[model samples]
Target: MTLEQLQTLNSIVLHGSLKSAAEALHKTQPALSMAIKKLEAEYGFEILDRTGYRLGLTAPGKAFYQKAQELLLNAEQLHSLGQHLASGNEALVRLAYDAVCPHNLIFNVLKKCQYEYPQTELHVFGESRFGALELLQKAEIDLAISPWWPTFHGVGDFQALKIGTFEILLVAAPQLFNGQAVTNIDQLKSEVNLVSEESELRFDSENLMLIKGACKWKTRDMQTLKQMLLSGLGWGYIPRHLAEQELKEGRLVPLTPQGLDFSIQGELCLVRREESTLGPVASMIWQSFVPPL
Candidate 1:
């Protein structure tokens, strides 16, 4: 009938007795009984089985309680949403992050945001290479976390904070080279090279560290590229974090060609467009990474 009445029933079911429910709900036992009685009288059915020593729901009451529980959850969310709107929090915030960014770091920030802004919906996207930057450049997302390269300065007018660093190691299963260390790039000339490509090919010209003459296989994300490398299909660069265990287990081995750098470290930055103004929730997330002064 009312949320309070449904809450009373839920409390009784949870606590297993009217006396305990009364103590929990701050109502007298007699009043709790009258509430259940009123509900049964209106519905023409017993809502609780009084014959048992401990209180239990009747067969029909079980079904009714299930629906009531759903209603209570929705009501709680609606109340939170009302408070969120009253406080002028944005309804939604979108974030685009590079696949190479450490997931735990991003999730930790998001966990804090969720607790502080329960009603603000967060939409997250995992992108490859310059994918997140491209989305931010187009004004499609409120925030982005991606590996920052000097070439990115030419992408757009943007501001960034150096949140962390990411290392990409040139790796492949040892079987690719018959368990021998590759001594020259010529050894890979005939082999298929796994490469993770950007979603929109907007920064294809900036593809550094790629084996120039190798037969190339393009993947859309790092996981797929890692899988291909693990399968001995080709050698490619992958985030060091993603392949740490594999490297330890000798499933993947780092490659060192005669003159090529086998590993590269770049600044992982949280970026936003210079001209775009962020909403309250988005601004909160952006400020979360600011160093304490």
Candidate 2:
């Protein structure tokens, strides 16, 4: 019914207790209960599952909660639009990008944003794997670009467009492989595999890490992985573009073990929450990303 009642219901669900929700909203338990009863009466459907030991949402209540969340987000966006219009300058655009995304591409887009939207503030967060997407879901960032995709079923109203693909090269110092082919998983697993730290955070059933080697080394950044590979400490996947010079100079050798796919490929995607429309500045930046030739 009213925004106040909707927020009250949301709080109750969020806090999972009438008393906790009351404390959070600075209201009493009786008032919170009254609000829920009013909503249920108006909708003619149960919103909260009072049968549970602790208050929980019923089937209909779950659906209603989703709709309420969407409505709340839209309302917040409307308010932000009004503020931007009144000031003639948007407040800020929070952006998070995966480290594996090409630096040149990102910097080029940033330059275009700075030139076109001088008044808008850009707060950039550099993350890896699903980190950027996690921030996007929390509404902490307005836009995201990462190689990571959502779970197989996907999240609510999240849209991702293919921006470009980066080659995931399996390379190592010649000493590690000794110029011998690494065809079997066992041989590959025997050597230390340098991989991104973000790989550990993935829990999706579909999005499994490329290297399942028993002996593994983790680095927070790609540069560190490259350095370790050059030092013959470990062998793992790195962006082909970053290792192009090394590959050409014979400093690193690609491993193509028989019956195994060594060259891992991935796409960079521009991801955003479809529930909220992009502001003018964010829109401009979003359109600047084109599929790399």
Candidate 3:
């Protein structure tokens, strides 16, 4: 009927006797017995079989005790969550990572945060070009992992830590070129360029390593763009790591446009708004990416 009574019954079951349960709970044997008696009377069932040398649960009591144990576990978790909130920990933290950034870098820190603050909920989103930054600027996310671009410098007052580097390579399915080496932009003009469209519409015109004057097809994310390239639907730039196996297997081949670098490397950064305040869990995640002093 009550948590205290339920706890008393649990102690008796664990210790196998009222006297032992009383000693474990720092209470008198009669007091422990009174708690159980009240519980059984309220529920109209005998909770324990005292005729045995050691106390055992009655058939009905087994089901009742099982339910009580589940309630006790939930209560403990609720108490812990209340304490976590009281300590200035946020109940939820939002994180957005650019599709171009490797998940391993961000997950390394998130895994630690999850272990330390099990009560805080993590909302993770994978965004296309500039998507993470847009979310951060809109105050929709607490943190973002994205490739750094000069365009970002004028976008917001952001604090960025260079976490790693990402490379985008121009590639196409070998079948698109029919085993012929592509040496000029003119050759690509006849084929569709599979471009991953910018996440933010304002930046839709921005193109990275796009071949000029080529017929274009657009996708919302790089993964689809890579799939399109793999199917010989078009040629486009994609994260090298995303297609490493395909490139090596000769399913996709790298392209070198004349007078232009087909491969581009950029800094992958952990970004947060300079003026926003982060709660305990978010701060812990941010610090996890910092190098040792």
Candidate 4:
């Protein structure tokens, strides 16, 4: 019914507790509760399921929450537009990318765009590659940076523009190989230490790490695996970016026999859903990454 009510609802939905939401909104619990009740009565809809310790939004509440977010974003954008009108015409382009994707994809592209057209803004969200695809499908983001793979099964009709490709490498602590080299899967049989990625882990389902007789050592995150490698506990397939510094300093060794590295053919792509209004900023950012090649 009101902006205050919408803000309160959104906060409650985000924080999942009346007390925390009230604290975030700088309102007393009783006052917040009363305001929510008034809004519910006016809208004739139940928003919060507060009969428990953690309050959850009902179905209607979820819908209202999304609408509220869009409204708030519009209002904020309008305010920003007013400031830009007086100053300059700069607006942010939103992007979400996978962790393994090249870090400089957005940065380099944005730098070029700014150099060519300084009146534009850039906002980047680095996340899992699969998650980036979801943001694209939901129209929550203008551009998504991911590897060359169909994220959702059977959605092969999506458009993708390849930016560049990088190699995936294998790394192990110096002690893991006893100062020698590891080549084929036979040498790695049951000897391989399967270090797993914990953050942004949307892409690793379906036992993708099977290597002959390798013993799996699945940790919840990369830090653990990194520590394991540093401590000479096991071997892992690390992204070249995550290990290039270590490899350069001789902390880890390349396991590809030639003492080189194995490559998984990683590629960066700029993507948008088929049905969406990609503004001028989105098109420019995409072109900035992939030109007339």
Which candidate has the top score in lDDT?
1
Residue 285 accuracy (lDDT) in model 4? 77
Clashes (backbone N, CA, C under 3 Å), per candidate, total 0, 1, 0, 4
By lDDT rank, best first, the candidates go: 1, 3, 2, 4
| 236 Cα displacement, candidate 4 (Å) | 1.8
Clashes of 1: 0
- TM-score (C-alpha, index-matched) for candidate 1: 0.82
**Candidate 4 lDDT:** 0.71
Displacement of residue 286 (Cα, Å) in model 3 is 1.6
Better candidate by lDDT, 2 or 4: 2
lDDT of 1 by residue, 62-172 (tens): 999999999999999999899998888889899999877989978988999999988999999999877898889888899999989777777788899988999999889
Q: After superposition, how far is residue 43 of candidate 4 from its true place, in Å?
A: 41
Compared with the true structure, what per-residue lDDT tens digits does model 4 show for residues 25-130?
8899988889889998988999888777789878898887788899988877777667655554437667888656767656877777677555466777766425
Superposed on all Cα atoms, the candidates' RMSDs to the truth, in angstroms, are 3.3, 16.5, 2.0, 14.2
Stronger candidate by TM-score (2 vs 4) = 2
lDDT of 3 by residue, 223-278 (tens): 88888899999888888888989999999999987887898889999899999998
Better model by lDDT, 3 or 4? 3
- The 10-residue segment of model 1 with minimum total lDDT is 198-207
Q: What stretches of model 4 exceed 4 Å from their correct place?
A: 1-80, 83-92, 112-123, 138-140, 149-153, 189-192, 195-204, 217-228, 257-261
Better of 1 and 2 by lDDT: 1
